[model samples]
Target: MSNYRNHFMSHIKTTIGELLEKLEQHNWRHSVYVNEPEDTSIHTVCFVIDTDSAELENDVFTPSIAAQNGLREFLPVHDLQGVREYLANVGVSGTPEAELFAIMHYFKWDTYPSERELAAYQ
Candidate 1:
């Protein structure tokens, strides 16, 4: 792989690791997944916190609502913000979808676009 690719991969891995560590300290369990809409071009990464401890009436709860109820904190506004900022500094677009795609690509996750396609968003 090229040196630039290696550097980007290394940075993303480190950023994720640190974010996981912080989440763990807050007793938040997390998982990553790909959300592939029917329109495949819009596939995006999802970072979810375990909600086992959250109360649900009729199973209705958004991440923000769960966080308000003492569930795992909404990572996007807190931890993931750092990742977004890093992506922006590296010339990636600031949109959530763009950040998700960049994270998915760097982490070698499922549903990521090709390197050339991703580069176009930078």
Candidate 2:
């Protein structure tokens, strides 16, 4: 693995560990799956919600405050304020580039948000 890969994995493990510990501290037991991206071309950082699980499902509907902070660091842009709107305007979808951006962003990698998603907002 490249140094970046190792560093990123370390960050991921640390984050997950902290999250799991918080759950345990609250006397909450949970199951977690740390899945790696399957396709070689797609480096998706994903969290799949088990639709039946209350916590995970609740998480999905909520916007991620962390997403903006992490996204700003990874993307070339100096700001995150307009990203979701930008993505919407740009018409970003499941295209490979969009997929990569989504996946990488989840992993805290800063691929720029799709311009199409942004343009449509105006």
Candidate 3:
């Protein structure tokens, strides 16, 4: 079982590395979020790759329409499709979201409610 797990993780890492390279080639900025739910009932890891880019438009900037929609059209269709299928087969799940709120909710940061109160305490 350990050998199988090692092989599975290795394959996933290799696939993600290849996909990141492809994204870089197209000059797209990307973020990868991985969540392993604390609930034992949920047996899969949630892997999301969010990508974005800006386009030059009449001296203004606009988001890439293709990327906004999804990677299907922005990237070669087969590239993303193959990755999705591979993940599904391995009992892993992959998804996309417009924002990173899902994973951000789990993060804790050291912040003060007001700068004045923090300065006084210091």
Candidate 4:
């Protein structure tokens, strides 16, 4: 994976880990990251979505879908929603991590999603 994507992926994982602490299930997997093909230099973040809604008690990393290390089951974008969008549109945005995830989630998923069952975290 590109260094940029790798950096952001780790960032999202950390963010999700923190988010999980506040959720009902503090033990569910949040997200995963991996390098993408050279064709797209930007990067890719895949959010996992389980229609079954089963609870996972440990950290999950799903790479079966691709060669890079994406979170298990699926991945989700953390941005692309609420004030964050407003901030970016108004030129007052540029927060790292979350903002980056939002952009990737919105563009990446929109351009190509592993499956339609789940949406980017946004």
Candidate 5:
């Protein structure tokens, strides 16, 4: 991840954490978009403060979908860890560990945030 993105995510992480506290929301959802159409490394980490609605149950709140639906802006993160930490901070108490587990499960189940290897053909 570039330094600029790191800084950006850091800023948003703090802002979102504050938002989560102020909202005092228990239900939240997130979507990860790895390999963005525009830039592969530019993975998007999207979060929805409210997800109790039935319509959002099917991973409909993902980054791409959220952006398309005009629900929220696509927040970019450097890596899966960044996404996990952000979710942890925004989620209700004791949700960080759970968020990490769920994120890993989602990545495995959905095969997202595809790995990228850069090396010479040796």
Candidate 6:
């Protein structure tokens, strides 16, 4: 990975860490899968979260108010099939140029909203 890619990944990891911490505190569990770009592909970051249950069908993971606001920039997947399709279409490997574009498309970090913005999102 280039220095630029490494830096971006580090930033994303840090943001993810903070989000995970908040989610865990609120009874939300998550899993993240990252596919590093290869010679011709792009990086793919897949984030999946669930509630207290471990079972795929049983777990009812709804984004908390804070999480929802914080993740406003991401393309939220509502169905398992959609998530699977996204992963399948965007394989884990890509060239540096492709990866750069991938960074702009996937695994985006989000921002927290103020009280008024929060109310609007709700």
Best by TM-score: 1
Alpha-carbon deviation at 42 in model 1, angstroms: 4.1
Model 6 root mean square deviation, Cα atoms = 16.0
The 0-to-1 C-alpha lDDT of every candidate, in the order given, reads 0.39, 0.31, 0.28, 0.34, 0.33, 0.30
Instruction: For residues 17-117, write the lDDT of model 2, one tens digit per residue.
Output: 23222322221122222333223133323221122332322446322332322311222111222333345456654344544345445445445544553
Write one digit per residue (lDDT tens) for candidate 4, span 14-110. 3333332222322233333334422222234433332224233334433333323433332333333432444444544334444444444444455
lDDT of 1 by residue, 1-122 (tens): 11222321211112233343333333223332223322222222223433444344464644443334333322332334445556656666655466656554544443334546657676
**Superposition-based RMSD of candidate 1 using all C-alpha atoms, in angstroms:** 13.5
lDDT tens digits, residue span 8-87, model 3: 22112122334433333321233332332232112222222223333423534322332343222122323334444444
Please estimate how well model 4 matches the true structure, expressed as its whole-model Cα lDDT: 0.34
Ranked candidates, highest TM-score first = 1, 2, 4, 6, 5, 3
| 10 residues in a row with least lDDT, candidate 4 | 1-10
Compute each candidate's TM-score over C-alphas.
0.31, 0.25, 0.20, 0.23, 0.21, 0.22
- Residues 1-122 of candidate 5: C-alpha lDDT, one tens digit per residue: 11222321312222233332323322234222222323212123324322223234246643333445444432223334454554444542324334334345444454322222101100
Q: What C-alpha RMSD separates each model from the true structure?
A: 13.5, 14.9, 16.2, 14.9, 12.5, 16.0
Per-residue lDDT for 93 in model 1? 69
Q: Is 1 or 3 the stronger prediction by lDDT?
A: 1
lDDT of 6 by residue, 1-122 (tens): 21222321212222322332232232112333233213212333333333233232222343342243333223332222232333335453223343233333344323222234223222
- In model 4, what lDDT does residue 5 have? 30
Ranking by lDDT: 1, 4, 5, 2, 6, 3
Error of 3 at 119 (Å): 42
Q: After best superposition, candidate 2 residue 77: deviation in angstroms?
A: 24
Better of 3 and 6 by TM-score: 6
Instruction: Output the lDDT of residue 77, model 4.
Output: 31
Candidate 5, residue 88: CA error in Å? Answer: 13
Question: Worst ten-residue run, lDDT, model 5?
Answer: 113-122
